[model samples]
Target: MTQERVAMIRERLQQALPVQHLDVEDESHLHVGHAGAKDGGGHFRVLVVSDAFDGLAPLKRHRLVYDAMGDAMRRDTIHALSIRALTPAEYERETA
Candidate 1:
């Protein structure tokens, strides 16, 4: 289920954004009995790099990602999303 959710999320984000680098990590197990986990939704952390976010404000970037996740967020497949939206240059600098 964790792998499936990650795949689904990766696909959705890729389809919605021109991602240069994307990583999705399932953190549900780390949550254990947290209220959201008990409700059956998954927790995920996403690091996405895309030119699509080039000029967007941080909140707008998050909104774009949330919009991309559309059904996953709305349907409870994703309980919480920790996202780091970055442009390719930003990613390169961070890694450097």
Candidate 2:
């Protein structure tokens, strides 16, 4: 189920943006027994590198990521998301 959710998230983001690199990690186990976890939603962290975020501010970039997550969020499939949205250049600089 976790793998399926991750694949769905990746597919959604890829469809919405020109994704250069993407990683989605499930962290639900770390949050077990937490209040939000009671609802069956999972915690996830995502690192998304795309040219689509080139000139966007942090909030805007996050919004893009959230928008890409559309239904998953609305339906409670994703309870919490830690997002790292960056342009390809930014990714390279940060990783260097």
- The numbered model that scores best in TM-score is 2
Against the correct fold, how does model 2 do in TM-score?
0.97
- Residue range 2-39, candidate 2, lDDT tens digits: 99989999999999999999999999999999988899
After TM-score superposition, the amount by which residue 24's alpha carbon in candidate 1 deviates from its true location, in angstroms, is 0.5
Positional deviation of 88 in candidate 1, in angstroms? 0.5
In terms of lDDT, the best-performing candidate is 2
**How well does candidate 1 score on lDDT at residue 21?**
100
State the local distance difference test value for candidate 1.
Answer: 0.94
Show model 2 residue runs off by greater than 4 Å: none
- Lowest lDDT sum, 10 consecutive residues, model 1, at 69-78
Report every candidate's CA lDDT: 0.94, 0.95
Per-residue error at 54 for model 2, in Å?
0.6
Candidate 2 Cα deviation (angstroms), residue 96: 1.8
